[model samples]
Target: MLGGIIEFLLLKQSLPIGLSLLISATVVSLIAVLIHRLFIAKTKNATELSLIIMTIGISITIRGIVGILVDKNAHPVKPFLSFSSVSLFNLVFSSQYVIVIFSTLVLAFLLYFYLKKTLSGKIMQAVSMNSLAARLFGIDVGLVQMSSFAISGFIGALAGAVIAPISFVQYDMGIMFGLKGFAACVVGGFGNNNGALIGGLIIGVAESLSAGYISSSYKDLIAFLIMILVLFVKPSGLFASKDVERI
Candidate 1:
């Protein structure tokens, strides 16, 4: 969705970079919300299964659409920020990498604070723990779910924008990202945000080291291998409790 929009706006319409990205993000979010309301919200049982299937279907549909509308070839996005590289402790980092890291940290902090401090966040947490109890306590479960989906869409769009400049955008870019994200969640603990952050960092470092030492071609393989090891060792995830909750 975003790749197609960016390609169309930049190549055919000749829009400015910022505007194109903004429009793409907004459109994608709206479409996601619509899909959630139509397909996701209506599930009565096996909601997680429905969601997983729908998500995969949506991803494939978006990829197919983008391949049809835009060329399957990777498209380059103009650099939004440019600065000289900085070196510290014999390691060099680009300004863009710094920006991405800083942005991710800030977003994570903000999200943690929101989930810890805000009433809406509390309601969301409550719903996650027990939707029936949350509703019994007068919380709007539907609203919470919709808000989560909207936030997810926004964050996903932001991620796409951030990565597009560093790596060329392509129709199938979401596949690897989605897999890594899922692996991170699984390794971190399914319901723990901080664990997800830690897991992502671990995965990132592991992949980089694997590529640097072993083989660049096996970087992705290393990530999955880590995930499999984690699963085998701690199926509940690193941060999850051994005891299962009884609903």
Candidate 2:
């Protein structure tokens, strides 16, 4: 919803495609939770997996219905930005992809700082890591859990909006990417936003490189392989620490 509007705004302003997508993605992602938390509150689902399943199911169902109703062969909207590249050091990447990278980085740092510095952030980290102790401290566990899901959902939707243009976002579009990203969240360490960010980036770059140098069909598989390897080696995820503060 927000992505669509931002795309329209970019078209109106004549902003570059890459810049428009990046800006819109961040803005809309920041707002996507208005709906994500709405659903979570109405339904009583807990845990990231449950929220993920719920959101994924909704995305697929809506898209599937649209695909059937709209006629799947309809032409997609064209990119509002250019694919031309400019030098940014030594590596050459899509101007759009570069924006994605930078946007992710900014979001990651903001989240990390929020978690490490603010009172609410500490409450969330403590609650997520140890609900019993958090409750013992008189924190509302349900509220904290909702906040966590809300943040995750907002990020997911933001990813959906940003990546939608890079690929044609049909009704069924969110599944593969969402699955890969969720795997990334797990491999990076659940409850750790920094982990999710790094995991997503690693997955994204690996995916891009694999598709560029290897096979496009194998791009998505890399996330699963990474997840399996990480599970076997670390079990708790690459960034998980003893500081999870389990109750």
Candidate 3:
């Protein structure tokens, strides 16, 4: 929500879309780091549930603040390219959709390379797997945690910026995307990037099909329903690996 609004404001100022997205992503990344450092990291004896609640509180606070400051109105974002739509194989797609798909693939590959080939990324994996053990090995767990927050924020802001052109920018727009993302994660299985990517694809296709065949009003519902069904049949997700270390 905030990211989309920031990008919208930057575009309003006649900034190049690339520059606006970069600025928005950087600002949000900084904000996420501050959130972890000031609130999350400062918490004592925090359980998963407590952290989840605190994050939810923080999200609500940010949403309310943005609504108050930016007004509760939807703003249109222009497509990044000149063309509005494109046709391929007799099918039509929004140009922005192609951009979104290409961007997602490129980012995923970069993230995969970072996590698999970089020492810092290995340290992050170690920290996530066993923070206490990583600390014993002299790794800075806190720094890794902060870095994770920054990466998440940066990716989220970029997603919001790109998606705004298709979904419209509004204070409350993140909620649905957030929910759907969580559903995708559930469907994909936690801790598996490949699973996540496949899960997101599944959810996206399901929503599109539902909107076309059933009703647009129930498209979001279809994603969650698939998630629930996946949980029932395969709680670990469709592509979940039995070996935790490999994931």
lDDT of model number 2: 0.67
Ranking by lDDT: 3, 1, 2
Give the whole-model CA lDDT for all candidates, comma-separated. 0.77, 0.67, 0.91
Task: Kindly list the per-residue Cα lDDT of model 1 for residues 19-74, writing each as its tens digit.
Answer: 77677767777877887898778767747777789878877887898789776887
Which pairs of residues clash in candidate 2, taking residues 3 or more apart in a chain or in different chains? 17-81, 63-171
Clashes of each: 0, 2, 0
Per-model root-mean-square deviation over C-alphas? 2.8, 4.8, 2.4
Model 3, 112: alpha-carbon shift in Å?
0.7
What are the TM-scores, per candidate, against the unseen true structure?
Answer: 0.88, 0.71, 0.95
RMSD of 2: 4.8
Model 1 lowest lDDT segment of ten? 3-12
lDDT per residue for candidate 2 within 126-213, as digits (tens), equals 8866789999999987777666655665565555555555675555565677678777876788767778777877887888899899
- In angstroms, the error of model 1 at 128 is 1.4
> Deviation in angstroms for 82 in model 1?
2.8
Residue pairs with backbone atoms closer than 3 Å in model 3 (clashes):
none
User: After superposing candidate 2, which stretches have Cα over 4 Å from the reference?
Assistant: 1-59, 65-83, 212-214, 242-247
| Better TM-score candidate (1, 3) | 3
